[model samples]
Target chain A: MNEKAYFSEQIRLYEQNIYGLALSILKNEHDAADVMQDAILKAYSSLHTLRDRRKFKSWILSIVHNTAIEHLRRQKPTIDIDEQYDLAAPEPTVDPETRHTVRAAIEQLSLAHREVIVLYYYENYSTGQIAEILDLPPATVRQQLFRARKALSKHLNKEDFDR
Target chain B: MTTPSDRDIRRQLEAEGRPAVPDFVHQMTEATLAALPEKLPVQRRPSPFKRISAAAACAALLMLGVLPNVSPAYAQAAGRIPLLGSLIRVLTIRNYTYDDGSHLLEADIPHVEDDDNAEAAALINADIDALTNAAVSRFYHELELSGQGYGSIHIDYETVTATDRWFTLQLRVTETAASSTTYLKYYHIDRQTGRHVGFGDLFAPDSFAALEAAIRAEMQAQMDADPQIDYYIEDEQPDGAPTTLSADQPFFFTENGDLVIVYDKYTIAPGSMGNPAFTIPKSVYEPLLK
Candidate 1:
């Protein structure tokens, strides 16, 4: 009914998903935390203009994405540590010697791929939900998942078996 | 052997995200909730014709010896009539000059009172207005003729601080995309109260771009009365920040010393009356309120 109760309820409903969205974009805990703060702050500031209740998740996610992109722009370093390792054949993940390598490979993928992976696997969102959250077509989301899987499989040194 | 299923891949990757969100988010939410205003400021700028008329009025007043000698009380009362006249003319897209002091052009959009979806409807209504304005005029006409589309007009309102030119109106619209039921938004500024109130539409629309043009023509004339500044749009980012023709951050400087910036993005749509009209934040162009 009141502004406080209104937004607080919204936060309660999608806060975790929002955090998860930010984490997918930022990767690291500290940056993701900062992005979360920025997203929530912006949403709070602009909440008065919002009219639709059903689109809150998508709306909030859009805010989170914009804030994250702006933050990333200011930082100027597009960091994807795990993505680089994915390019190279990684070590066996069952062993600790290769677990770090596997992690590195995951990070080495492009931010776009990493985003799909994070949303699909890490956040437990279906491809459809991920597509809506990211404002992408469902087919595109499916394709990204396909590519992300191929890339991750290659890095895990399981391309032969996995593919 | 078959490859790992998409579901399997999804499960494996889901493990990588943060195990938990920090405790501060709750604290931040509390702080944010506490910080939110009881009433949200309407962000719509005044209509373009209102801005032009305001400018035209100033130019006319300065040319006549009448502006300097005019008393504050006489000017205030006189100022409103021209604005009301100009706005009615501009919004109707017909030339009209009315001397009647009692007439006020009011656009009403009735919406649902449900709080859950009000904000989204408000945002969409505004967005649709802005998007239509930015789109080419022919594109706008196509939308209009199809009996299904949205449109918007850019309005800039301004006047000297000495002259009291405040534009006020109550706007209402519905957003069906957000809910099954309609919502009503009361977009009005109490010139006496200085209070700006806005909410969502009351009913769902088969087509949301119902009232874009009529409201635009009406609001445009209201804004054209104030002559504070003029602007043109360089670029617009839907779902992102607007890029303005202004060269500086916030308000930019020109060879002449006037505060100028592209402040509004209007949407055109069908109204409750089934007429096309515009909707946006009145505050964006509230610079003219000065």
Candidate 2:
């Protein structure tokens, strides 16, 4: 197969994963779509940088991750601490009627926590791999996971979930 | 209600993450692919035909018994045709990837592919190794001392110019922390000399003062011609840019053999000016060149 065709097929297979990652990081549909396009072009241009084609999945995702971060960085000089939220105290109570599904609970997470969770739980990257992807320390990834779990427990921690 | 298990969370995460992604390849890549140059310089793949041709050439040579028992006459003739002897190329020797939450590094260091020109290739390769290793070790040293810092360096290279007369390999490094900056180191071989020539080797040492003046004049001319263009020329800015051009200043030659002196960002101007380059027309530097 020609290089172009092969590349197109690969993108076809991974487009959903690309969109998912961008959406989780950007948390906005329009912006996520823009990033998906940017990431695709970026991956296509820099394909030579990847020595092994087998590593394409993680490599492309990392490019998407970097592109998304760069987009966010351009929008604002620095991420505001206020927006990151206090993981220590999540919420007082959960309304039974508005019972948070795991998906909905994840949506409530700050960008910092949301990205790691999605990459880990959804994509199954290891803490070490996640560190490389997100440019974080392995230890920090572990700590974030710990805090993220505590924070999610506020919403997922309920009494009648057996059903 | 009870807490969900990791499996349950994974299922829900899947539900949230997977949306039907449209056929974005055509929509996105067509324009990008069209806009890109026919070939990216960093692409190292040799075509199937080239490989076949190389094999055929080897077989032909062996049929003539040139390979099994090469004659001094053939050796001298083959030396003129570089392909018949050996082809030099650039190869990615190693990729150094590391991250510690605060400090990160991703370097794809390349070396001149070994060939009969091992002596010259070795020199270029050694320089590349030293530059790359120093950057990586510097990151680690900072990580060890402070326990926290935010810096990243990405090393990529391209063969900018390759011909029978001259060969240039550019090692482009981008370092990022609070902000990003780019640095370029160029290696060149004047095929006529068969020896790698640096900026100093190209020009007579005593002539640098004149060359520095020439470069400063170009910087000033650019600024004068366009208000948008700026540089940190002496007395133009408070701190003043370097007044003297060092012998080892980073540079590369044009196809026409013009000399372009390069300065990394924040060296000759503010970061906004980017990497400043001044090309000395061959006519201007001809007398100074060796």
Candidate 3:
């Protein structure tokens, strides 16, 4: 396939992965969506630098990680009145009454913990690969993952009494 | 209440990501694809060998003694005493330079002078004229497009290999607009045969496939060895990526008689990989050589 076709295929295949990654970092769906657009376009423009097409998933995710962080940094001190609503936690898709599903548990974790968990579990990236994508030391990623799992277990154990 | 294991957590997360992407994101993806040019712009890569053979400009010439003093009186008297016999010389016959701030052009046109081999000289000269002229014409065309200058094409030549049996001339052309791109063309002549030799000429008709496969293997090996190195091996680029060598593929025989296959900058790899060349030992392809 031509580069454009290949790139289009990859984007479609990984769009959800891209969105999840950005959402985990930004926690604001609108901002995450914007960041996703920025990162994908950035990856497309710089695709020539990637030596191996197989590494494209990780490479693009790394770009998304960096772009989301930058967006977080540039956000204004005072949220716009309309945007403040988006900043609030997104409503849970399932287990509406409990509000303690694994998805909700993941949303409650710190950004650092959330990022590692998504990369490790959702993307199936190795610890070393996660460190590379997040630009964190491997030790930090391991520590964050360890702590995140502990917190998640704790969060999930306090399950729905409504069940 | 039971806590979830890592696998359970992963499954749930995967489930969360499974819903269809938002309509807005699909639109954005479409828009991004639309924004891209129909053809991906091949990034201009710097030639890796450029540092080794810098074409230092010698815009003018002053060679009085070496060349046949083709003075009108001398020409009339002897008719033609074609200089030192069989001596090979390359001199900058003309230098075209124009720089009005934005648009600049530097063309150091060279002539291959071989007194005993005028045929070879004429062949090389004609080809060089065509290349430089095309480059110059494009430079003017682009210049006229914008009232302000866009870029320049600097054409220069370097003799990469010159031996009693073989002579290889490498012409490097660099064109720059918003960015710069550089490509190379090599011309080789077999002194013994009094004829030009190239990728196809040196190989048997049936050897083309083997030669292409060998070059492709080298490309894969290079990328495997160095993660930073990349070739458009199977980028499915209908045009730029090569599954076959050009009839006059840029190549030269080393003094050691090793056959080197060369692709111009941005030919097989991006501009950053520069001009890629692989040297195959003479023995490997000895049977294939004509």
Candidate 4:
């Protein structure tokens, strides 16, 4: 296949993964759309720069990750530490009624923790793959995964009670 | 009340439907695909030994004083040899490419070394190489720190004018991070004295004010004549008056000898304006030319 056709097919194959990753990082549907658009355009323009065709999936995911982070940085220059640490105290509760609540709780986690959880649990990427995509150390990814699970559990428990 | 188990969380996450690709994304991708060039840029990989041989041959020819008697076709043929094929007069000496998956650099660089203007040529070539190398190293350094996405730097050049008396080279260095940004630089050489020239060398001393005024008037007049052509004068100066061109402002001479002033993106207008350039007729600056 031609370069454009190949690129288009790659985009089609990974469109859902790209969008899901962007949405997980950005936590807003509209922002995720914008990031996806920007990342796709960027990937298309610089396709020649991709030396390894085998790593195309991870390569594009890295672009999306960076683009979303850049967008978030531009939107809010300074992140709130208190907001990240304000995890709800976990309480024993029955399983939630809908997956929507769990997804919403995931979105409530800080950008750093949320991304690791989504990549690990949702995308099923290994810690090494997540670390590579996020440009974090494996140790950091594991720590993030640990913290993210706690935050999610607490947030879901609280979310269930609030509902 | 009990917290959900990791298995339950994973199941719930898996159950979460994949976000649908927005309709606009598909439309935008299609539009982008349609807009892309039919052929991807050809990656030229000229071997180093061949380049050295070509340069040695050219230098030997120059030392033998054979270039003057040689046919233009022979001169042109020399350029088609290998690496430095185009470097004899106004050609790219090296179009370097480096891609290690994470970082990529492509530079179309010039190498000019006239027997008469050897010093000036060497200085200009060194300067260009230094700039390109610095940009490459900086990009690599940045990528090393933030290895999130691919980083690239492209350095392409255009020979604006190549006359016996004057030679002007325009270099565009585009560095891509999340988005691509381009910076423009111009190199001018006085072939006779073998001296690198800048804005100051082009005109008579004390003639800068008149030249600036003339350029501003011409740009403003052009903007007034064409609705599609709007400069950033209004955005730059709230009063909407043309700002005086700086003495060291970037510029080049067209083959017709007209002065073309170039502004980097976001300097005079929004990036949509994209490196705005205004050409002033030769007649306007005739008296000012040194």
Candidate 5:
């Protein structure tokens, strides 16, 4: 296939993953859409830079990761400290209602924590893959997953009190 | 109710639905393809003197209204001809205007493709796009929160050198809000191999100490020669001098191939001093060149 055709096929196959990754990071559908478009154009324009075709999935996702983070950083000057809580809190009860609570809790996570969790659990990316896409150390990705899970549990448990 | 185990949480997360891709993806793909240059235009090869004279003539004609009647396409094609083509070409890829009229973003992004250095060109383009996007987005976000000011961001690029052996492109970004500041970034490519060059790549690996010493000595002499000139002095300065230079510090080569070390505002001096740059002649470090 020609270059444009190849780029289009690759983008078509990965569009959902790219959108999901952006939404996970930005936590806003509109911003996520904007990031997805920007990332696609950028990837298409620079496809020749891909040295290893085997790593195409990670390469495209890395663009989405950077674009989303850039969008988030532009949206706010300071991080919301409230999004980060103590990770040693007790786990919440796993009732059917916990399923409803999970998404909301995920939205409350800091951008860094939410990214690893979504890439790992939702996208089924390994820690190594997530680290590569996010340009972070694998050890750091694992640590983020641990803290993110704890934070989610704490948020879900706190929701029970509001009820 | 029992507490949720990590396994349970993981299962639920996996089961959660992802956001749907928007309809705009196809539109964006089409737009991108349409914008892609189908074939690389033949480079306008002209002697240095002729190129300058032609550029000057074009500018003169443009100012005289003689070129105004020409169609844009015709003008563009004419401009790309060997005698009329510009030394550097910059094109606007994207622009953003806020609904509230509080801010504007204009990106005159660069791309290098269809050349011997296509891969290097792609890398340079990607880096520039990332930087420009991040800066514009940050400014946009700030404007959204403040909701009371006017601001503009512009990113433009220039070709510092475009020879067969070496290609250097420089990006100048100006962001204006309550205040304005311009940041400079450069991309240097070894055109033959399509490899990006960093500050350390220009010198021998083991010659960092000599470079640092030379730079420090030059900086000191410059300060001594002019009382108005000053660099940041570390509080612990045994000799009241700046710290040692890092290999990764920002630098670029002059037309004469001299090295100019650049420090961002407040990096080596106070913000009022702006970005301070010192040129070290090639003679100073000729032995260090790789």
Candidate 6:
């Protein structure tokens, strides 16, 4: 296949996933859109050099992550300790305050830890998959997951499970 | 009584409603496609002979014998042109102008091409020295390879391109012992405009023997040039060996002035070198540079 067709096909396959990744990181829809636009511009501009087509998904995802980080660093958006509850999560049983508390607790964790949580929890990535996506060792991914779990546990410990 | 297990957190987060993604995403692919230069106007209804010519053009691209000259432009556009490998820490591009004017970009390398010629040259020199050190160290370790008749010996740097907004650096290395050459180029991409303003090339000759001879000659020259400078300071033998080390080997200088040499097959002295001329003390460096 010609280069343009090949790249456009790749873009179609991964567009939603890339968008989802950006959304998880940026939180706000508008910011996520901006990140997505920038990432796609970059991806399309550099599409010719993908040596291993098999790894394209992961490669695109990495670009998105780095682009999001760059945008976030520039903006330095303020995170409300309470806004963490917007995990966009469907835990309706949990009270708003409690959910917010748990999210806030998750937010308090370092960026490294937060990335693992976002990947595993929101993106539904397996440990091995997450390892490749983040360019981290498997052991490191597992450790971050373990720490994220521990942090969540501490927050839930202060409130009842049913409430 | 639902427990918030790892799987549960994942499920809950995934279950939440995702906001509508912006419209620009779907448009991005189209925009990029639109930006492409129009193909040369060829006859639409070519005869069978013309079709054969088209097929021949495609075939030529795949011919293994013609590998080197096949338009590096594709690789650069693909962003797969290994921006960096061993020996290169960074690549920064300078000023960039878009023919289509879709995006114009410019980048600033802290150590290169800022109105200060002396400062930029010194930074570039240090970068070269660090790369040299890496090449020498790699030669040092490749020598330790067991039962191998093969060895490599060439190392050098090349300038890919330097402009006001775009700079390209390619770190080229060849290992004769391994019968392979690695090419890595780092692009300091400009944020404001999408251009690379500067570039670097870190290359080694194809033969281990040649690489070694060249390194020894370079080191000897450096040593003889400044006999007054101490070549064998404390910890010169980073691994506690009595062998001496040189500072020109792309040594890593932390913000704190810690000197660490990152050569092929070797990484030495994490936090020992005194202040480097490139760096101000942390108290001063942080406030000014950061």
Name the top lDDT candidate: 3
lDDT of 6: 0.43
Cα-based lDDT at residue A29, candidate 5: 71
Estimate TM-scores for all models.
0.41, 0.46, 0.48, 0.46, 0.42, 0.40
lDDT of 4 by residue, B1-290 (tens): 25566777766655665567778766765675566555543221211111123343344334324322212122232232222234336556655566766567776666665566677878777667656545544454454434445568887777777765667777788876654557787887876677887776676557767776765676689667875444544344212324556555678887677888876553444333466777768888887777
| Model 4 lDDT, full chain set | 0.64
Q: Which of the two, 2 or 6, has more DockQ?
A: 6
For candidate 3, write residues B90-204 as lDDT tens digits: 7676566666666677777676777667788788877776566555554554554433323677878888778878878888888764334576878777888877666667876
Task: For candidate 1, write residues A56-146 as lDDT tens digits.
Answer: 7766876776667656655765754334323423332333234433345556666667777767765566765565555454556687778
CA lDDT, candidate 6, residue B166 = 36
For all the predictions, what are the DockQ values? 0.15, 0.11, 0.13, 0.12, 0.11, 0.13
User: In model 2, what are the clashing residue pairs, if there are any?
Assistant: A136-B101, A137-B100, A137-B101, A158-B1, A159-B1, A160-B1, A161-B1, A161-B2
Clashing pairs in 5: none
Best by TM-score: 3
| Candidate 2 local lDDT, B6-89, one digit each (tens) | 676776655555555555534664554444344432232211101123333344334334222212131122112122125666
How good is the docking of model 1, as DockQ? 0.15
Give me the displacement of residue A100 in model 4, in angstroms.
Answer: 21
Candidate 3: where is the Cα deviation over 4 Å?
A: A1-163, B1-86, B234-240
How high is the lDDT of residue B244 in model 6?
A: 30
Q: Which ten residues in a row have the lowest lDDT in candidate 4 chain B?
A: B42-51
Over B172-233, each residue of candidate 1 has an lDDT whose tens digit, in order, gives: 22221111112221232223333332211111232123222223344456447633211112
Best candidate (score: DockQ):
1
Question: Clash number for every model?
Answer: 100, 8, 1, 5, 0, 61
